[model samples]
Target: MDRRIDGLRVLACLMVVLLHVSSSHIHEFGPKWWSANVWDGLSRACVPLFFMLSGSTLLGRSESLTDFFRKRALRILPPLLLWSCFYLWWLWHNNAPTGNWLLAILRGPTMFHLWYFYAIAGLYLFMPVMRRFYQYSTQQEKIFFLVTWFLVASVYPTVQSLYTDVQCGRAGLLGDVYQLQYFGGYLGYLVLGAYLAERRIAWQKGAALFAVSSVGTILLTYWLSKRLGMPCEFFHLYLTPLVVLAAAGAFIAFLGQPAAPSSAGLQWLSGCTLGVYGLHPFVIDRLLISRGWMNSTGWVWIDPLIGTAAVFLVSLAVIGAIRLIKPLRWMV
Candidate 1:
C-alpha cells in the first residue's frame, strides 16, 4: 500500500471516531449542538474516503476471480462474521432484545457501524466485473459515467430534499426506465478512487477543494436543519455533492503529499484501524453509559473531543491485546 494511503486510513479511522462521538450530541439541541454538528459534518468524509481508498487499492489488481474471493474470504469474511456475532452478543448482554442470532447475522449488521462490513462485502462481489469494465473503458467514458453518477446519486437527492413538493414524476420515471440506480451508490466512489489514483493532483488544488467543500457542507447542513426545524442529515449523506467533493479532495491531498517511508508505528496503527472501528462503539458505550463520561467536563464542546480520543485509544489498546493472541489476530 502507498504510505500516504496508510496515512489516510489512520486519518479516516480517527474521523470515524470523531463522527460517532460528535453524533451523540446532534439531537441534544444543547449549547454545543452546532459545534458537534460541525465536527460531524467535517467527519462525514470518513466513509467515502475509506471507499475511495479501497477502490484505489483493489480495482487495479490483476488477480483472477477465484484468487480475489480466496483473499477476501480469508481476510474479510471471518472478521465480518465474528464481529457480527460479537456485536449481537453485546447487544443481547445489554438487554437490547436480539431476536435470533442466526437470523440477525443473516439479516445484516447487528450494530450500526457493522453496516460498513456488509457494504464492503457487497462491493467485493462486483469488483471483479467492475475491474473488467475499468480495464476496458476509455477515460472519456469513465468521466462521463462519473458525471452521470454524480448527477443521479448526489445532485438528485439534494434537489429532492430542497424542493420536497416539486414533483418530477416523469423525470423520475425516466430515470427508473434507464435504471439510473445502477450508476449510483458507493460503486462510483470505487471507480472514482481507481480513476483519481492514476492522476497526480497538486496539493494546493486538493487543499482548496477540501476547505471549500467542508465549509459548504457545514453551512448547508446548518441551513437545512434549521429550515426543517430538526437535525437534518441531507447534506451529511455520504453521496451528497459536498461530501463527494470533500472525500475526493481529501484523497487527492493525501496522494499529493511528498512520499516518505512509513514508520513501523504508523503501519501498525493502520493495520489496527479496522479493529479499532469494530470495537470503538462498544468502548464508547462503556465510557459514556458505564463510566458516565457523556458529560465528563460539563462542557459539551470539550466532552466529545475528550470522549473521541478516549474511545479511540481504548479501542486500539483492546485490539492490540487481541492481536497478541494467535488464533484471534486474523479477525482484527
Candidate 2:
C-alpha cells in the first residue's frame, strides 16, 4: 500500500469535513460568507482527488468482472444500504418531507453525500473494460482520448457558459463534428489518475504554478458569484478545468513527497475515513448547528475551525467504537 495515498485519503477526508462545516454557515452575509467561501473553494479538490486516487489504485489491477463486482459490493453496498435506512429514519424523525423513497434509494441515500457511492458503483461496473482499454492502448492513443475528453467536456461547456443565451443540452458544433458526448465525463479523471501514477513526470515549478492557479480559481469563483448574484458553482465542479488542474497538481505534489514511517495511528484514522465521511454531515447539520454548539461567535475563522475539528473528532470516536464490533464492522 502507498502510505502517500493513505495520507492523501486522510487529507481529502478532512477537507470534506471542513467543506461541509464551511457550507453550513455560508448563507451568512459579509465576513462570514467570505470566510466560508475561502474554505469551500479551497476544498473543491476533495472529491476530484478521491476519483483520481481511485484511478491510481484500482484502474490497472487484474481482476475478473465477477470478482470485481463481489469485492466492490462487499465494500460499498452494505454501507450504502445501512446509511440509506439511517438517513431515512433521521429524516422522518425531523419531519423532513421525502417525496419518494424508492426514487431516493435509486438515486442515492437520503443524505446528499451518499451519492458518491452510487457514482463509484457505476464506475466499478465499467472499470474492468476500461482497464482492458488501458492495457491495449498506445501512449498516443491515450493522449488522444484525454485531449478529446478535455476539449469536449471541460473547455467547450465553460466557454458556452459565458453566453447566457446558449441553451445547454444542445451539442452545437462540437456535437456535430463527432459523437463527443459519449466520450466525455469522469472517465477522463480515471485515465488521468492512472496516467499520472504510472508516469514519473518531472513537475519542476509545477507546485508554484498550481498554488497560483488555485488561488486564482478561488478568487474568480468568489468574484463571479458576487457579481452575478448567483452561485458560480461551475468553477468548483469536479469536471471543470480549473478543479481538474488543482486536483491533479495536488495528487502529483503528494506523490513526490517521501512517504512517512508507518504508524498504526495514521492507518486506523485512514481506515475510519469512510465512516467519518458518512456520519459528519449528521453531526454538522443535526448536532453541532442544531444544538447551537457551532455559531458565529463573531470570530469567522475560529468558529468554523473549532466546529470542523469537533465534528471530525466526534465522528472518528464513533466510527472507532463501531469498528470494534465484529458483525457491525462491515457497515462503516
In order, candidate lDDTs are 0.85, 0.78
Candidate 1 lDDT over 1-332, as tens digits, reads 56898999999999999999888767756688888888887899999988999899998889988999999878788888888989888878878999979899889888899889988889999999999998889999989989988888778866775776533211253267777778767889999988988888897788789888989998998887788888876678787889999999988899888878788888889989999999998898887758888779887778888888899999999998999898998999
Leading candidate by TM-score: 1
lDDT of 2 at 139: 89
lDDT tens per residue, model 2, 219-251: 877777788786555566666677777778877
Candidate 1 Cα errors over 4 Å, as ranges: 165-174
Candidate 1, TM-score vs. the true structure? 0.94
RMSD in order of candidates: 2.4, 2.5
Relative to the true structure, candidate 2 reaches a TM of: 0.91
